[model samples]
Target: MDFSLSDEQRAIQDMAAKFAEREIAPHVAAYDREERFPLEIYAKMGPLGLTGGVIPEKFGGTGMDHVTYALVIMELARHCPALAGAASWASGVAGVSVLRFGSEELKQKYLVPLAQGKVPAAIALTEPHTGSDVASMRTRVIRTDEGYILRGNKIWVSMIKSCGWMIAFGTLDPALGRKGVCAFVVEPQWPGVTTVPFKNKVGFRPMETGEVAFDDVHVPASHLIGQEGEGFRVAMCSVENGRLGVAARSCGMLRGCLEEALDYIPSRQTFGEPIGNRQLIQSKITDMVVWHETARLLTLKLASLKDQGHRARQEASMAKMYASDVLMRGAEHAMQIHGAYACSDDFAVGRFWRDAKFMQVIEGTNEIHRWLIAEFALGYRR
Candidate 1:
């Protein structure tokens, strides 16, 4: 299959790269240190229609294909992964749920404003009780004449501290496994909704992750996305698509680490000789390159499948798993090449190190992804 970018793809990538260089790379250092969400950066992205890249024209989006979206993600991620994280959160919260699944009214009410970047959005799925067992979520939504009352807590929802809406998933009936789960669009200012911001992450600090508590939060029936007993499927679908975005991001991080390590090794001195001249450093760099290409190759393969209207579950998992590992190991090598300088923000490698570790945790932990890959290969059907 041809992996070369079309003219349109190149244009989008150029635009994303320009935005990242001017808007993200300069301010990322201070933002990362402060652990703050970059609203100005999001505002710049909104004008590019970045917030609506994959939604249809009717849904107020550019309606671009998935591969183009993935390219934009990669270009932006290369400059600053935190900015990429914010864009990723906004894209999924606005496009996938409403443009793909929500009713007309839900799209108008939430997705429209979200696409314009007047407000941001996030997905709240993981709870204190639920990890990879999405069907076992303990959050409950009790029906009412008006709508539903939500009672549960979601953990590690990123960038919602300033978002205007949350696409939340919960169970109408827990005993029903996947079938009982349902999805809803809940506004941030809803009467019983409360959020406590989390700070001091090892990496990706600019994304602003946190906890969301739905203490008898009341939502209207009209806000239900798709229908009752359909939440789990929608959540899984959103996450599956979302993983492609993560793969794009991980590749960007891996490439950054690899480039940094390569650039440093040749210039670094060891015993009056270039350390990169040594065989050991060459071997480490070679290993990093291998993993990085593996990540990129898997990402492109899954992206091709997605464009062909095929399921890309296994491909996405493999890309995420390998790309994250590459980023982590490459970051380690980057730090080693720079020695103690990598520990400081003085070098980009330190931030990449922390951010790469954070990537390993988000999207789905490597542990979870491994289980999925193993299960698929073993022909285990759930």
Candidate 2:
């Protein structure tokens, strides 16, 4: 089988890689340490033509393919997973949804600014009561003369503070189940909308996850994406895109672990020679290489399927599960190689370890994905 990136993909990968090393690498650690979002950097990416890679040129984007987008995400994530997460949430999840289902007016209003990095958008799915079980959400949206009135609380909403608009989900009637849900383009600055920061996060500190509360927030009719009662489908579509993004980020984390381990092994001397000479250290490093390569390939496969207009729901789950699992493994191995030093902020492995665990939890937990994969294999699901 041929395994070569297209010229466009290679160019994006190279540009992203160099940009990460030169721009992201120097400031990411400081952002993480300060637990502050790298708000300005995202806007700066617009001039580099990196902000609108997901949508078409008509929507103020370059119309880059999914595989190329994945490559760029991986490169950004190698140094700053939080920054990569923000970019993916803005471009892949929320931005793509607008491109797919939004009206021309909505596209001109929100998507164009988002593509230009003048405005950030967020996908509001997770709630305090409902995590992955989105159908059971208690947030209610009622039809009114002016428009829809939204009253709900969304927790663990990433980039909330930085986002000007939110692609939010709410249920009109709980008895209708998923059919009762609808997606709305919510203005965060509207009256009765409030946000609270999630303090002291374990990882992804620079991404700024928060809780958003909507109390009688009026949403105009023009902001509704797709038809009423189609919120579940819209949310799932965004989620599929997000799953691939997470997989790419996991691949980046694995690469970082390998690179960090390689740099440390030779310089760290044990007994009479370098620790790299030992069989155990060599074995861990070898496994890390295998994990990184395998995860990267799986991520690319998912991206390719997406570019081909395939649904990719099942394959995205598999890629996300396997890649995230590999990331956790690589982080653990890096920690073992670094020994005591891994516990301190002096090394990057500690952050990777925490972030890898977070990866498994988000974009649907690994356990949930495993069950879904099993169903797909058993011919019970498609």
Candidate 3:
């Protein structure tokens, strides 16, 4: 039960930390203010292998292990979760599906460019009406002599315009339920594909999240990921990676809250004395430390399980659920400690608070995870 990071892992962690402080920290406020994706920052990340840590070297990625990948995400997220998320979308969430299920031609076309950070990618499973209920998705795909014709709408798709391609899931037949699900690689520039950006998001404003409408878009046969009727499996397999990424980001957010609160506490004065002298303030700081450590450990445990090739569905849910909850609560407490200043955009704690709420909603809602954790414990699911 060795818990310490290996020398290589430590080096990678340090490198990511330096990159975040040097590259992302300076631009976070401006990007968030403008609600713009930092394409230039991502360009730098591609050359540093930050954009493709999970991908294989053969695909032009750094071929790092999952633990190292988690560490990188954690470091990047400490400064900007949006940047960490964009990196994960390209490397783990979107790229892993193609790496595992995509054909050789698909890999050569998408993964090569994705690993190089030349283009980002997106996964479109959530629809206008369906989120967790994937089987109930209204998107439909019809088989044609040329390929597949897709007609459906996907919402909350991040990096819509910037992604070179996206893996979209749709049902072949409405009556077939999950068995009818099919996944396809759809290029955003196709004739029938249209995207509408979601504006005024509470958090992750720097990310380009939007709705994508595929109106009878033609997809080449070679673009299909895995076999027909296998889209459900493809979507399910990617959850672990998605959950792990969210958990790692939550840990980083928790750390950010702790650091922000710690920095402000002593300097803040109350009753002509430092707020850090108050026991209540100290207690909140203590809770932040505990939450950060707990989240990090759970996230790392899940990452280790993945690297060992173990089935960690339950663990992934647990880590994602707990870490996100901690992030939400920690951000709240940090805000509370900051008092009126927390509400202002001048402080990072407010940003953390806004972003923390989204973590609980994305990956899987905390409510859904609670149900899953209990079901796994009761032997209702395996």
Sorted on TM-score, best first, the list reads 3, 2, 1
Show where candidate 3 strays beyond 4 Å. none
Candidate 3, residue 260: Cα displacement in angstroms equals: 0.8
- Error (Å) of candidate 2 at residue 22 is 0.7
What tens digits encode model 2's per-residue C-alpha lDDT throughout 71-151? Answer: 888998898897677557545768877888899998999998888767778778888988978899989999998879999
The candidate, 1 or 3, that scores higher on TM-score is: 3
On lDDT, the stronger of 1 and 3 is 3
Q: For candidate 3, write residues 1-382 as lDDT tens digits.
A: 4678889999989999999999998889889989898999998988888888788889878888889999999999999998888768755657888888999898999988888888888888899888988899989999999899999899998888688899999999978999999998889999999988788999889878999999999998888999998999888877888899999999998898899898888788989999999999889888889888888899999999988988699999999999999999999999999999998888899998999999999988999999999999999999
TM-score of each: 0.95, 0.97, 0.98
* lDDT for each residue of candidate 1 in 4-110, tens digit (9 for 90 to 100): 89998888888888888888888878888999888878887877877666666666666677778777778778778866765665456445767667888888878
- lDDT score at residue 152, model 2, on the 0-100 scale: 89
Q: How far off is residue 38 in model 3, in Å?
A: 0.3
TM-score result, candidate 2 = 0.97
* Error at 146, model 2, angstroms: 1.2
C-alpha lDDT values of all predictions: 0.80, 0.86, 0.89
The 10 consecutive residues of candidate 2 with the worst lDDT sum are 84-93
